[model samples]
Each structure stands twice: as C-alpha cells, then as structure tokens.
Target: MSAQAVDGLSRRGLLKFSVGATAFLATAGVTASLSGCSSSDTAPGFDALRTSDLPFLLAVIPVMLDGALTGIPSQSATERTLHGLDSGLSHLSPEMLKLTRQLFDVLGMAITRGPLTGIWSPWENAEPGQIRHFLGRWENSSLELLRQGHSSLLQLVLMAWYSQPQSWAGCGYPGPPKI
Candidate 1:
C-alpha cells in the first residue's frame, strides 16, 4: 500500500524483486558450491570471515569509515576494525550469518566480484577511487539487493568503528556518563 516509487517500480514491486533476486543469488551460490568455490581456509584472527573475504572488507572499511580512520596508522586501524567486525559478527542470527557469508562469497569470487562490485583488482591493489565508485554504484543501484548490500556494509563498518572507544573522539561522542 506504500505510494513510494523508485525508478518507476512501486515499493511492493521492489520488495518482490528483492526477494526474487535473493532467491536467484542463493541458487547461484548453491550452483557455484558444486564447483568448490565456497571453501576458503580460515583467516588467522577472524571467526566469521574466510581468509579471502578479509581483504575485501579491509578494502571497504577505510572507504566507509574514512574520516574516523584518518591520522590512524593504516595497519593498526585495519586490525582493530577487523577484530571489532569479527566480534560483532559472532552474534548474528543464523539466517543473517548465512546471507552475510553469501555476500562475502560473491565478493571473493573473481568473475562475480568484478561485475557485481566493480572492483576488478585484488583489494590490496585497489585504488580508493575504484572502491568509492563501487560503493556509489551499490548505494544508488536500482536493484534493492544492491542497495541493501550497501546499507549492510555501511552499517557494519560504522557500527564496528563507532563502538570502539578510540573512534568516539572523532565523532565527538564522549563515553557514557557515570551513574
């Protein structure tokens, strides 16, 4: 019953498309699984993310949390952020965890990652400009799934960063007042 329209698709239509797209992507993931593309050795310090997915999230954190990360040593900031993200992810519901893993898998695959995210190079080799373009495309995409992916990534990075005491100073938020 919503009146809003995005790119001429009604809100209901968009929701339907999003559901259908997710189903299709889920199916694609299953198909890709048969090719042995879903398995990756665990990263050294991460619990929820595979070794291959870490670089993509690393590439994303700086871009998504730019102002907050400024002046911090890149290596230290990245490690802290990754640790925070891993901690937060440990609490996700099973369904959410599955969807997140699927997203990571899509980003880790060369053929799909380039076309879907527009960052063709390995994350370490990717320029900030390329990462920004990829973010912009997802945030502004007509497809609801892409927009949701953008929102999910942005929220995850911001939540993980802002939850840290060190990040509070940048955002002008002091710690909770004593009782």
Candidate 2:
C-alpha cells in the first residue's frame, strides 16, 4: 500500500526532513562524544545524568520551576530534583534514552550548543536571561526538532520535581493517604 501523504509536504520532502534531522542529531552526538567533552561519567549519585548535564540542569531548574521551588533551599531542592530525574530517566525505553542523551550531548558541547542554542558561554556560566532566551528560542522555534527537544527537557524536569515527596506539599497533595 502507498503511504498517505500530508496535504502540503510531499513524501520526498518529509523523507528529506527526517533524514536531515537524524543526520544532525548523529553529527551532534558524534562530535560531542569525540571532543572528549561529553563525559559519560554520571553526576554525583546520579544513575543517568552525566557530569556534563549537571550545570545545565542546575541553571535550568530554577528558571523552569520558578514559583514551584519557593521556600525550598535552592541547592537541596536542585539536587533532589536531579536525583529524581536520574532515577526516572533510568526507566525510559532505550530509544528514548538515546534521544535524550543526544539532546544533552548537543547542549553539553560548545560547538553545537552555541550555534544551536545561542548560548555561547558554558552552562555553568549561563545567566537566567540567557537560559530563558535559549529555552524560548527552542520552544517557539519553527523547527519541529527544536520544539520537541524543548518539550522533552521540560517534561523530564517537571516530572522529576513533582514526583519527589518533598514537592508534594507545594502542590497541596497529601502523602497518598498514608499508604
């Protein structure tokens, strides 16, 4: 059976876009990995997140969680959230995991990160406004890949924090009837 085509884009166009996106991701991951920059070493006590991921997450969580983190000691809450993210991400299907690692790889390395995200400084040195600009750029980008990447990162961070018991009180959720 022939595949049904979308109204505006021809199958060849769709195929070209898919191949380009895949090639871009592969290039990003391979470049980052070969640069000896995207360390596979996990963050302290983290099973999934690499050391390279820490600074990015640390800088992002504050802005992403804004009011949700009020009253919590920033450092402790961030650590807990990262730990939860590691735990949660460890259970993702292998394909999802690879996609996530690719996203992290792209964001972790200087070459791809600067061009793609418009944040020239390293994640550790990125200011709130810079991070905001990057996130906004990706979230509202015309590229589907960028938007999907933004959504994936946002969902992971939010789920990680909200899954933790410490965050329950912030959302008015009791401890599951003491079970």
Error of 2 at 127 (Å): 0.8
Model 1 stretches astray by more than 4 angstroms: 1-24, 32-34
> What lDDT, from 0 to 1, does candidate 2 have?
0.83
Q: Report lDDT (Cα) of residue 6, candidate 2.
A: 57
Worst 10 residues of 2 by lDDT: 1-10
Kindly report which residue pairs in candidate 1 clash with one another: none
User: Could you tell me every candidate's TM-score relative to the true structure?
Assistant: 0.81, 0.83
Clashing pairs in 2: none
Off-target runs (Cα >4 Å) in candidate 2 are: 1-22
Residue 42, model 1: Cα distance from true site in angstroms: 3.3
- Could you tally the backbone clashes for each prediction? 0, 0
**After TM-score superposition, what is the CA distance of residue 123 in candidate 2 from its true location, in Å?**
0.9
